[model samples]
Target: MTQAVTVRRDGDTFQARLFWWHAARLLDPGSPIIRVGFENGPKSFDDIWVEYDPKRSAQDQYGAPLRREHVQCKWHVSPDTYGYSHLIDPEFINANTRSLLQRARDAQLAYAPDGIGVRFKLLTNWRLDRADPLRQMIGTRSGAIRLERLYGSATDNSKAGAVRKAWRDHLGLDEEELRVLARTLAFGEATDTLDGLRDNLDVLFAYVGLRRIPRNESAFPYDDVVFQWMAQDRLEFDRKSFPAICDRDGLLGQGEGRRHVYGVKSFEHPIDRLEERCHQVLDLIPAFDERYIRSEADWGDALYPALRAFLLSAARDQSKLRLALDAHATLAFAAGSVLNIKSGRHVELEQRTTGERIWAADDFPPDVNWASLEAEVVELDPQRPDLAIAVSLTHDIAPDVRRYLSATVPTVGRLLMLTPSTGPGAQSVACGRHAFELAEAATRMVREARGSSPVAAVHLFVAAPNGFTFFLGQRQPVLGPVRLYEFDFEGGRDRSYTPSLTLPISTRTGDPV
Candidate 1:
């Protein structure tokens, strides 16, 4: 039997696991949710609402791409009266209930052709009391008569009726809208709590053959693991791509043939081999002196310090740290995508490399005139104009970059915009093949533009997956010098751009030198 540890609950751990649970559903290849995120969305929900397209596959999911469903998360160590009651009580609606309602109203309006319907869902760990009428009311699509019957009137004098009347008055909803609310509001339950998720994460690592970090030694590094996973996978992890090592059913001995096979034979050989593989991957994860893995040591703070120390050690020569840091950021962003928003940098180390190979397109698009597509160019007028190329993959090219280009450059050279077919105001990159084709097109543009004007340098403003960035660098047309700029989220969307690193172009080979 596997060891079971009673883990303590922390809010951060709960949120992390909740995020992962949401990931399992929304990030699944067949799921409709194309994007999701933490704590930075609509007013009411602490968790993000997602815009899901049922037709799309798993590769499309990104963080906070669109909004469709407002998810509110409520965490409790155990089932409680206040928490359960507050979910439905009108006065107890989350702080920004009015805003959420307004957004919902906008979605329902017929005048807005592109309007998307929004729904509210409360995710909780507590096993709901099915017997409770309010719980049942939220669980079902219809307004329950229990409250109405108990109170006898919409304006009943009793406390229950008063509460019901207050809720209706607060929402200012008519009968039809109230019915819509009953249908729109829903609840979802997870199998794990904070400690449960931590334990399972260890199991996940162990399934890949990694040794467990004892609970007493450190809280499970959920965020670090998630960052590493996203970075390594190029933000493409989903349920089918990355399944839980052991699910609730499997842990309960309910898995198909597991019980029968256990009685008939010893499967230690295969299990041992699998565990060995897990160990191999575990070896790749950077570990510190074991002192920093504490649960209370600033939630998810272990990775940065460990990464900094690793970079410093590897870049023993202080003079080489800048270049090393750039190289490290490249690998971390491209492979693991561990970007730090505040500093406008990617947070990851140089030592670790992903087992999975980064994606690349196999062939270029056969047909299509690359030159005909008007290239949006910026000329600084220094004899040979420096070419600035902005390729938008997951995010729309920031409007600020567009304004800057328009304002700084007097005349238009050429502009080509690639956007996602599915998302609004954004261009999407399909599998690596499409990304490669896009890169080839960019290269063609460079060559064509250089033929007409003496191009001295290239500056890239890319809002794309790190894999696409790596592939873009690979497919760059031969140029004298290339500088890439990282988007500045702090400066506002699509506005501020900062210099990241220069791609050294080889004059001899015409490739990234």
Candidate 2:
């Protein structure tokens, strides 16, 4: 499985956090801090010296991005229970809550009653990338606030040695006792005592195997990715988020398959509100709202059972639908997509060499105007074809066979092209003698679609290497292959062109280059 570590952004780089999975394994739920402990997860969870180091961002070449090797992490939750700052620092406090909610949702979403025992589970993973650096950082980082967050008062035995001794002396009774001691370690006005003990397997976690969480990127905020991965096979990931309590609709699955999510709250609330939040969390996925995936009436019957369960609960002050869309994994070796479309083959293009046989459209020049639309319908009164308006298109070809056809394609046709996000955004080397002619073609497509045509709107599409910047003239036009397409909104017409070369994209998204 591809390793992933959960992280929250601290200024520029992400600060590692302890998530639900670690808390479930390390903390006992019955402890006094359970509500706050699980609710805060790592955000408020204090840090003891974890044996992990951060990977800094840097750069070498001039003007190249520089990855900083280190930055003082100021976000560690304060160890002072009395520290008035955490309650005051809105950002930190909200972050603490958000982190907890994310994990809680993860736990609940992944819950399996048939499992052997009951325990909160954080369904995530990480990697060995920081293995070496973590060890080295730990060596020089001794005596630093072990738990970055607040813990019990340090004993005089020595800040480092004392904390260890305190646990060693009173706690380490047995495997079971270890769990209790871990939970009870929290300090508050009232204190709880540890009791049970079990086998302490003959082993050592000399390395706590604790690393700060990693910050993963998302495309459509949250919900968009859900559907993109679920309804649409556009993007794939190893794991994704889900919520614990799902309403009847079961939309949280991202339409891909069953997913797990967690639900968290500091205080009790009503069920409808909870259900609303559940939908709200789901709203964060792919299409924003359920309606985006399916029509309301179409999904009405399917969602009835789930809605009834929630409505009844609400009537009795019992309806509670946890908005628990936790992350899930759709991870696997999905095929690589075509990035750019230049006139060339794939194998030799990886290294960006001219060795691959690349030919422009001119190399296989056709005297005939490929822009003819005699077979295509334009004006439509109900799938009626739009006017097959003729346009004066002209272009010169390059020695490499590059040719730009400047003819205006009728908007009332289907425009087939690869998604721009999937490939490089490119423009053909051609000029329109009269740009208005091309604009008129677009107008016609829209008009036909409006005239009772089945097609609703004319879609204008374009492909760009990096996403388009509107200020920089980047358009949202459906980014597809190398070609740009403008078509009638209502008319079902076709306007496709030959592809050129392809570009390379990193497994990680949002890369500019």
Candidate 3:
């Protein structure tokens, strides 16, 4: 008799959870995913398969008109790392068998014979070795290989060249053949824990009309259903059949309309399911370090222009938008400016305070006495041309602002500290309406201060909720020549304020004021 196999339940469960994450998208008619499969694809990298509709702007991988992503999930209890040289090791390829590279090539020929539209992803909890040349060859945003790095000059003798040559020789392929394979391969770090994946699923469930797993309940309804399907050898889901399965499993709910979620990521921490949940994603992270802008011109040349273009295009179809911002205070404000009150669009901001809440200006009735700003003006050098305004709604940021100004910008002659009348704390702004009202009052106060002095420019430093910051940005036009600043929350550099975007972009030339 054959020995019974001991299954790694942790790995199995992780794969199953990942399957549901992609499979649930079928419930949304607007989603680009047309089909999802469990344990049913090419043998090499086939934990799951997701086919996307080519018509939609789907999948970060660009070349293919019709895209199908093949994913292999490798989950381990302990963290580990791999480097470029490990690709030919026994870990990736057994001695007498086809290597991972070979299998990828075979899968490409079988699915996309023309060498286009196919992506193979190795999704693991493992990290890439920081010291390896492979780290530099990978695109941070897309998870795809950086082709330019892989295809260096003919006389190249760098470590990257060695990696490329090794991979090519191991695969028994020519330069052109290696390039084709490189384009199709992606290595991605799985950032979610099992609990985190569940939380993410709950959010997706709410959006796609599935019954959410109760917080207090111990039962894993989605997991149980997936296991039962696996036992029954039911491995595939398409747009038509997935709904029937949902109905049979008593998982159906009143579905929401196609949500147009946009993610503006300008920081290190990533938003969960940003690419999957968002209709459009503005990846502005490349222009920033933890504390400062990489290049000052990035605001005008890259960040603002990209944001403006995306919002303008999205506004053409969507009357209402949902924004997920993992960004700086300055960009958050700039986003609000693009979709200002005059734009005739309703925007709901994903506000992650004590918990997640969708905040919109029209969600509640405005109260005249909800919140008020108490302003204090301090005199600096009278000869200086700039005035600094520190708006501390969440906490008192005046000390930090003062320190930053003293050490850096000597051009500021005055400092204006604005705090909520109720004193600075998290609940300073009562609701969305209160935030709008407070923003308006804050803008009015700035105009008054500017009028009293011959200040050439107003420097703004804000410590508040994203919704409030956005609302403040919407009112930017009336406040002349305003420069926004961002705090180094991550403490990557000196924990201080750094200048970011300047408002009132020139209309004709499309440049920052």
lDDT (C-alpha, whole model) for all candidates: 0.40, 0.21, 0.78
Per-residue error at 43 for model 3, in Å?
A: 2.7
lDDT of 1 at 435: 53
TM-score for candidate 1, please give it: 0.34
TM of each candidate vs. truth = 0.34, 0.18, 0.72
Q: Relative to the unseen true structure, what is the C-alpha lDDT of residue 201 in candidate 3, on a scale of 0 to 100?
A: 74
**Candidate 1 per-residue C-alpha lDDT over 1-513 given as tens digits, one digit per residue, 9 for 90 to 100:** 111221223444566665554453432232444555556454455454444554331110111122355566656555644333454444544453444444434334422223224445555555556444354333121111222333345554754455455446756766556544443444555445456565554433432323355768665555445544444443443334334422321321221111100000001110011111111111111221111112323212443333334433433333211111112222333222112122232222111011112233443443342222225444444443566666655556736566766665433344435443344222254444555565556667667766666655666666655445544554433544665554444222343554444544122332110
lDDT per residue for candidate 3 within 1-513, as digits (tens), equals 122122266677778888888898888876778888888788767788888777763444453454788888877777888877766664653335666677778887788665678888778788888778887777665667877877765643877778878887888888888888888878888777777677767777889999887877877778768878878888889999999988998989876655778888764332233555677788776575433678988987788888888777877777888888877888889988888878888888877554455678877887766768898989888899898999999999999999999999989998889999999998888777788788888888888777766778889999999989999888877777789887777454567776777887764554321
Model 2: lDDT of residue 302: 29
Best-to-worst lDDT order:
3, 1, 2
- Residue 62 in candidate 3 has what lDDT? 50
Best by TM-score: 3
* Candidate 2 lDDT (Cα, 0 to 1): 0.21
What value of lDDT does candidate 1 attain over all alpha carbons? 0.40
Where model 3 places Cα greater than 4 Å from the true spot, the runs are: 1-8, 57-66, 92-106, 112-114, 153-156, 260-320, 324-331, 341-346, 351-383, 387-454, 459-472, 475-480, 484-500, 506-513
Which residue ranges in model 1 land beyond 4 Å of their true spot? 1-384, 395-399, 406-427, 476-480, 492-494, 505-513
Return the lDDT, model 3, position 242.
Answer: 92
